[model samples]
Target: MIYADNAATTKISDKAFEKMLPFLQEQYGNASSQYSLGIKAKRAVEQARKQVAEAIGAQPAEITFTSGGSEANNWVLQGVTKLFKGEDIHIITSSIEHHSVLNVCRALETENIKVTYLQVNKNGLVLVDDVISAVKPNTKFVSIMLANNEIGTIQPIAEIGKYLHGKGILFHTDAVQAVGHIPVDINKLHVDFLSASAHKFNGAKGTGFLYKSASVDLPNLVFGGKQEHGYRAGTENVAGIVAAGYAIEENVKEMRKTAERLQAMVQTTVSEIRERIPDVWINGNAELRLPGTVNLGFNGVSGESLMNILDLKGVCVSTSSACNSGNDEPSHVLLALGVSEEQAKSAIRISYGKYNTIEEAEYVASAICDAYSKIKSAI
Candidate 1:
């Protein structure tokens, strides 16, 4: 398959898989047990934590393992919201955030916490000034994604985080789509918390982490025996965590070389699409987007129809977030960027990864143009 859905998830790397095998077989042990095997497991977990921390320029103690990005986001949103009871709490977040943040904000509303959904520009960016204007005396926290999943619009998270510092308020970023794909320095961003998923960067599924600063105290989302320094509790997935560390280390080390190739492919694809197809709109900030994510709106064609055709052609792409797949509704992110529902429904997202080749990109782009032509002709 000429897979172009890297934004949805990535396949595990050979190195990560090989490292995981030993943990799952002979090295398997309960991290909480008091034995040699358990001690080995505990050491693996700590090493993974350190690797993850180094990847993001954070302290190892700040990293807390979780199921994935979703849980980490929920933990921060719910845990922080619960901190202030019988008092006014306001959260400022972008309208184009991943469902992890949006859904949690919806639940926060029912708990008497006020949430302000900041609007994005046509390029799907939240302005720093808007964030400042949205903050009020009751505004207790701010949560926004480092980069959008579907459109790949990189947010001005560092600016927002820096501004919100020393105001007695907390800042968190859902960096699931941005972490390994680009350079992420938690200290530089000035964020109180950051969330990331392993699978997005070619690690095993069902594994991820959260970075919480020492100053930002939060209630535990999972209740059980002490693990993750009592911040998160459960039997740690030693194998998955070990694989994550290896994957992230590899991804970060080779990011620049990989990014250059992907960017070249993206340019070729976009130039081809525009030259061959008519009236197609490129979503998100062109210059500020992720390496190989292309969200294109074909005026006279349906995205779902194009996706089905692509799948039949052995090419994999997506309309939006995998979490919101099958919903059949226009993307909330596109709508936030002032795209009409009809236009939003006609957009497709194509994301590339390390495994994708220039030849695959050319073929995918050609196939899309062919599909669009057929769909437009019929319409």
Candidate 2:
């Protein structure tokens, strides 16, 4: 099968699975326990923490393990905002953020916390000046995705983070889509917090980490035992995390080469698909997109139907975010870009992984052409 839905999730890598195998069997010990096995598990967790942190240019102490990126994003949004619970506070976020970030912001709004939903351009690009204008006196934080998941629009995180530096307002980024695809340096971005998921790259699912600046402080989201340095309390997933660290490390090591290959595949896929389907339009910023993602709007075609057709033919793609799957609603990301509901409904997301080949890309392009034609003819 040709899997083009890398944005949704990825298969585990050989290196990751190899590193994780022992922990699942012989090393089955609670990291919090005091026995020799437990001590070994704890050490493994710490080593994983250091590996994840080093990959992002963060200190091991500043990184906290979570179930995934969603948890990390939710915890940061709620935890940081809780610090100003009684005060008149505001948050700055874009309308195009993933539901994890968007839902957290919406939840904050219900609590009477002011939230500024920054608008994006037709390319799903949030301008830096718009962010500047949205800042309020009580604006406590800014949460933006480093790269959009649905459309692959790479935001100006560094620019926004630099502008917010020393302004007494914390900055956070949901970097789940960009973490393994690109180089990420917290110091360079000047971000106070960042979220990333291991599954987005090739690590085990249900494993991710949050980067919290040393100067930033917030209450624990999960409280019971002293885990994650009293920041998040839970028995660490020793195996999943060991796999995550090794996976991320391996991904980072090969990112430059893999990214190049993915980009070439994207170029070829887009060119061939658009050539075959003349009315198709590429979504998001053309120059500032992720290396391997392509969100396409097949005019006069149903993305859902197209996805089903592709699936039946041993190819996999997405209509939008996996979280919003089965909802059949227009993508918020597309809507934020001012796309018509009809066009948004026609959008299909295709993301390539390092393992995907140009031959597979050509096959996907051909399948898309067949699916779009067949679907349109029936309509």
Candidate 3:
């Protein structure tokens, strides 16, 4: 099948898989133990931590491994809330954040924590001014995503981080969709916390990292073992961590070239689709979007129906965020961008990856055009 749903998850790289094999086989040992084998495992985990930290321009001690992006996001938010006491904790986030962030904010609301869900512009770009205006004396944290998962709009994270730094509020970014696919420098972004998932970057699932700036102090979420320097507690997934580190190392070495190729493919596909299908609306900021993502809406055509037809033709696409695929509700991101309910329901997200070729993109675009034609005729 032609897999165009890379935003959800990319296939694990062969290099990462090779690095994981030894850990899964003979190198299996609890990282918390002090025995010879355990010490070896512990060293491996530390080495992986160093590699991950280097990728994000963070210190080795600042990186905390977690189950995935969701856990990392939750840990940061919970840690912030715990450390701030009952000082009317407030959080600033966009309306299009992943459910991981949105649900956490909803739960925080029940605890009397104030939250401001900032609106996005027509291009799905969150305004830095809106963020500044939303901050109040009680605003303790600002959590925004570096790149949107559904529409691929890249946020002004560095700008927002600089603004929040002087306000004494902690800044966190969900970089799950941006880590390996784009350049991410923690120091440059000036973010206190950043979340990334391994599966999003051609690595094994069940492994991710949260980058916490050394300057920011927060409480530990898991309070058991001393794994991750007592910041997080759990037996380290040695194999997955090694794989994720190796994946990051390999991808960063060739990110620029890969991104350029994907960008060209996306531009070509968008042009072809617009030419074939009139009234097609491209969602999100056209110029500042991620190289591999294209969200489009075809008037009068349901995204679900088009997706089904494309799937039968061996193409995979998503009608909404992968985290909320089964839900029939319109996309919150699109609505936040001023799209109508009908436009939101007709939107489809197509994200490319390192494995996809220009030929595949062309074919997928053609198939999408065909699918829409068939679905519209049937209606």
Checking candidate 3 for backbone clashes, the offending pairs are: none
- Model 3: per-residue Cα lDDT over 130-176, one tens digit each: 99999898888999999999999999999999989988889999999
Alpha carbon lDDT of each predicted model: 0.92, 0.91, 0.92
Measured with C-alpha atoms, the lDDT of residue 71 in candidate 1 is: 93
Per-residue lDDT tens digits for candidate 2, residues 1-379, read: 9999999999889999998998999889999999999999999999999999999999999999999999999999999888888889999999999899889888888999889999999999999999999988888899989999999999999999999986878999999999978999999998999999999989999998999999989899798899999988888899999988998899999999998999888888889987877778988887789999999998888889999999999999999999899897799999988889999999899999978999999899899999988987897
As a TM-score, model 1 comes out at 0.98
Minimum summed lDDT over a 10-residue window in model 2 is located at 273-282
Candidate ranking (lDDT, best to worst): 1, 3, 2
Give the Cα error of residue 290 in candidate 2, in Å. 0.8
Query: Relative to the unseen true structure, what is the C-alpha lDDT of residue 106 in candidate 2, on a scale of 0 to 100?
Result: 88
Candidate 1 per-residue lDDT over residues 1-379, each given as its tens digit: 8999999999899999999898999999998889999999999999999999999998899899998999999999999888886789999999999888999999989888899999999999999999999999999999989999999999999899889996767999999999889999998999999999999999999999999997778897778889998877789999999999999999999999999989988988888898997578888898898997989998867899999999999999999899999998899998988988999999999999999999999999999998888887887
